[model samples]
Target: MSGSAQVRAWQPGLDGVVEVLHAYFPSHAYPSHTHDAWTILLVDEGVVRYDLDHREHGLTRAQVSLLPPNVPHDGRSVRPEGFRKRVLYLEPDRLGADLIGAAVDQPELLDPVLRRRIEQLHGVLADGREPLEAESRLTLIEQRLRQHLRRQVVRPAAHRDAGVAGRLREVLDAHLPGGITLDEASKLVHADPAYLVRAFSREYGIPPHRYLTGRRVDLARRQLLAGRPAAEVATLAGFYDQSHLTRHFRRMLGVTPSRFARS
Candidate 1:
């Protein structure tokens, strides 16, 4: 329980994730409302009381609440001191259909292992770790959640339009130094945005966004190695600014762009 209350929200730079919220409430309640995305709550301290699917549940620290998309729910502190929590709002398509079904059927999971893994993932994401490393951690977390829920594993059949992935990659490369969005890429390949993301990840082992970011990093590296100014390289590499380029460069390569150039 915290004496004061506060709430902060930010996107995690991942596809299909809406936002994450870190909050501490000493005395607050939420009126019934529905969300278009799934609301996943992780309680860190104290107690949280919420009603879902016409049932009331009191969740304590180390517990998780999985509210499916479009479900009406209300939440508040269960005790006098209130609670601290982290919440993730995810698009329904981000998770497999079967797993989402399992989550809806059993909304609250009381597994310490799952809770700890989720906490770890949050830390890595919040700290701005390497994009590839963060993606790996997130995949592992999803696998563990699926295991805990006892969901069936359904492997995807061979992709019908496997060449579309390659075409999408070509399109991405053609637009570099600028950028192409997921929607734009999907249209070029005549695929749905979600399908394109999954297909690209499966075909190349990285999502489109991460792949595009990596391309930007690769371009930046070359420009830096060629003795170009970091500011010019930022623009040449499709970054918003030098600071933005530096942030991703250091996260991916473990050194600042200038330092890397010096080395």
Candidate 2:
């Protein structure tokens, strides 16, 4: 441990959120371990190096790291000045299962806007005077994160067969509220993942992941219109939570789920 190292942990008044950590270290190195909840961290100063899924990542003030549940990882300071970080530990189910792949695949995000919003959220949590305000801000933060992770495939090859894409769509529709990975979908259709993505995009005008998300949004719309609570609609439509549902719903329909329900 470094001479200047310090760590603090506390809980916030929010469901599915486990705890928050604020820490500083000069030379301390954390041994590999796993967390039961998702570990989202904001690096406030200096630099930190970590390994997730056998890949190394360096996080700085402009970056955020999102580690999924039960994933083994290790960390240490990357500079002589050490590092300061704020971490939020949330239940694994706080985000949709469909989003986990991206989180695991790319744990660190270099977005200045997201970094600033997270800093503001930390301030609100530390003040402890505006629980609802903090919750709302957190919702937006998660939404931006999901949007960033959602990769868009542009201008797919036109030479692939359209029939295979149609069959894949049918399989996806049959498994609504449940998701199939690109690898799984490829195996089902006897095509490579790259080909499947391009072919799907060419035939449907959207990638498979986006297409499935749209279907879920459609289901959420019907449930909201039938008087179901937004939170319940989120679950029934395969969304991770109400915030997850709201993010996609607003993006697709130009209105939030609550507003859509009322209209």
Candidate 3:
């Protein structure tokens, strides 16, 4: 067994955020310590056993865990080939309203959207350049995390809006390229237009029209990367014009579409 281990640290973003990716061989352990920020650990390979809050939990590749600010925890690799994991550290105060009332002490698995968002956040943070992009990426991750935690949970006997929301999202995705009006989206879900507007806003943290526009912009960015001209991509993406697309592209990506595409 190895007598000791070393940790490699990587700082990818301009903000106070930092990523410490660990590779530990058998018998290696993390001594108990605490810090005033959030830590998310995703086990990329092998099994890990850790004691947090005096309770022991076994974690594997498919699982992700959170350590609250100032919580004492210790962990070690249990695999012979050693263990590899990605850890993201974010300041709670910097995160702000993005936490959406989520207590730092609560830990949960990353929902599908959140999983991808967090993954992207890591990718940007891993990049040695583009601290601006990393800051924006981290902000986006916090927003998604908050939305996931705020979603309404239905009881067993309760009527699930799950089916309704799912169906509506399907329709919205189908019409994304062309865009959909608030009334049109409401009709597809068979609910009052006003009620649907509020519900969709609550669920997505954005009105349906804005969400559709954002989706269209996402497509536009891809097209730009594929070598499409800005004007042409703007029209196909359902934007009123190139200037309209430019406004949103800058706001969301921190760069113009043309610049982002090239980068």
Candidate 4:
């Protein structure tokens, strides 16, 4: 391991995300290992030389690489300085098994759009506040990845589902503090989960989860101003707990619930 190596890993609240890792290794070599989830990697510094299916590949700054689940792979820095990388370990089903062969054959992609979107998705995932946003981004990224694997042209979907979007919004509003899962919303709205997310985001300025969080924050403010304790206000606002409420509240309002209440 490199003496200067630093790593941060966490499982985000997003259901589609298995885990996220950001690491820097000055000098380390990875032994062969296989993951149950897809490894989506972005190298930000230096270079990574990794072997997938016994073939060596180089991941550089310009590419987003996807290592298929259950593929044995190993990595080490191309230089003495090692490499810095951010990774998203996604659910195995995020991409179908049929594409595994394609991914294994060409794990590194030169698509700038995919790289940018993956970076943005990482940003959304890191916040841990916008599950809907993260899911939406993830869905599109997965779609693009599939297209790449299948050698199809990467293009935007021309269809819109305003009817499904409107119904999903109603479900979200009705569920409120209880909240609903994307799967649940999809089943209830009778639409594909990916379509539900894309449509909701387009119909409303914000994604459903963020919209719900905003509504919860609004309710929280009202309760705080009414002199309720932060803890109680959290429950009343539909947040999981005080800390949960604080995360979104502070992000939206720029102050903690306690501070807001005191003021």
Candidate 5:
């Protein structure tokens, strides 16, 4: 395996995806191990050999691998050059208990749609400014995975929950700078977390998280124009810090917050 300098890991802002990893292994083998979260793995170069539930498997660029939680597994490069990979360690409950069996039976998936989606997800995760997009992509990915596991069509969410969507939006508005978690939002609105996301998206034409971000940006703009410093406006406007506000501000308005205020 490569040195620690060659590997990077972090916890992202999204609740569904707990950790992100990018690593290269030059010549290392992993011992059997278990994780409390599901591992969504993609290999960018070389081949990886792995063991899950005492069965052998291989991962390559042509596939996306989903390893279920609490399952014993090990992995290593089959070639001397080893493998370079990106991984998202998702929360265990995101996939649920029923799908674990299907994963054990078929951990290696050869779906081009899934591979592309995972690649896109990793891109946004790296940017670290698109939590809303990340959550939406993850929702669809889970849908496809459940379809694979159940071997049946998982219907897309209906647009019949306008009332629920409207109420949830109000609740989100109430939560503000200290935004509510997905679980809390669902509980307050009396809906499933996934259903809440789907309903809000269908009714508003944007994800809940995006709506919140827009609101925060709006607040920042108002405060900035009032002559508040960028650093101070950051927290007052619900952003984590100045850089966080600057990233979203530049992305949404095509200029940095300071420049926007000058304009």
Candidate 6:
């Protein structure tokens, strides 16, 4: 995956119990991993093959999936179109931590009520606003996510091994403008290079190298969108050459960096 990182995260309210995220995986997969918070997803387009526990569950357009906290899982694309989904996060303490551990056997499916709430959530989140309208929508979504958690006994544990994964997050955030080798990042997380590879694949469903490359591409896109020269943005985004950047850009984003920049 290349072109630019388009993943975004935000906390929209004063409650602090909820967070929202939007991600576009053009040709990437998240390896097996768990989140510290609950993940409630609304599949907007394409398909996502979610590997939860030991079984693979395929979610297509309009399907809703709920992932309880600390549940080992990974994601894969079920088709060539790739997948795009919106995810909501709610904390365990707010959800009553013991609730999820009890329902580990049977998780709830997204019903119509939850589905409608998800649509509203997506509208507010995607708009990227801070007005009362956005805040009100955010609150509605937060309440709904928590309500689902209580009903399903799901707690927020969306990321895999929060303590260990936090280290990786730190490195990723630090090197977002460039790119980091999985080997080098492994040192920071205190995991062996090979193990890091396996773990990232298992937890996130994508290889670490691909993830880094995608992130670099994402950063380059942002710079280019701001009117930076392609050659200059390429180096700043950790590409060795513009051709290297261009090849990946077309492959992942389905357009040249210049074209995307114009958008």
- What TM-score do all the candidates reach, one by one? 0.54, 0.56, 0.47, 0.57, 0.57, 0.53
1 versus 5: better lDDT goes to: 5
Per-residue CA lDDT of candidate 3, range 1-263, in tens? 34333344444435656433443344456544343456777777688887764557777777666665534456777776556677776664644433422433345564666666667767766665777777777777777655544563522322335455556666777986776776787787888878776665544434566656656765775577567889899998888999999987655534567765554
Between which residue pairs do clashes occur in model 4?
none
Give the clashing pairs for model 2: none
Pitting candidate 3 against candidate 4, the one with the higher TM-score is 4
Candidate 1 local lDDT, 1-263, one digit each (tens): 45555655556776665666677767767644445467778988888887764568778776777776634566887788877888877776666556644664567888787777778767876886566766776677667666755753333545545577778877887898799888888888898888888766665545677767776876786677667889999999999999999988766544568876664
Q: Which whole-number lDDT from 0 to 100 does residue 136 have in model 4?
A: 92
User: Which stretches of model 3 miss by more than 4 angstroms?
Assistant: 1-6, 95-106, 148-263
Candidate 4 TM-score to native = 0.57
lDDT per residue, candidate 5, 1-263, as tens digits?
A: 44421455556678788677776666657655456578899999999999986789999999999998756677888887878889888888998977777888889899999999989988898899988999999889888888887873334434468788888878877887778899998888889999999987766556788777766875676677667899999999889999999987755544578876664
lDDT (Cα) of model 2: 0.75
CA lDDT of each prediction against the hidden true structure: 0.71, 0.75, 0.62, 0.79, 0.79, 0.65
Estimate, for each residue in 88-121, the C-alpha lDDT of model 2 and write its tens digit: 8777787765666677678888888888888888
Q: What is the per-residue lDDT of model 6 for residues 85-179, given as tens digits with 9 covering 90 to 100? A: 67776665555556565335444454677688677766766675745666576567656655655565444655565455546656776876666
Instruction: Name model 1 segments beyond 4 Å from true.
Output: 97-101, 150-263
lDDT assessment of candidate 4: 0.79
Q: How do all the candidates rank in terms of TM-score, highest first?
A: 4, 5, 2, 1, 6, 3
Candidate 4 Cα RMSD after full superposition onto the native fold (Å):
15.1
lDDT-wise, the better of 2 and 4 is 4
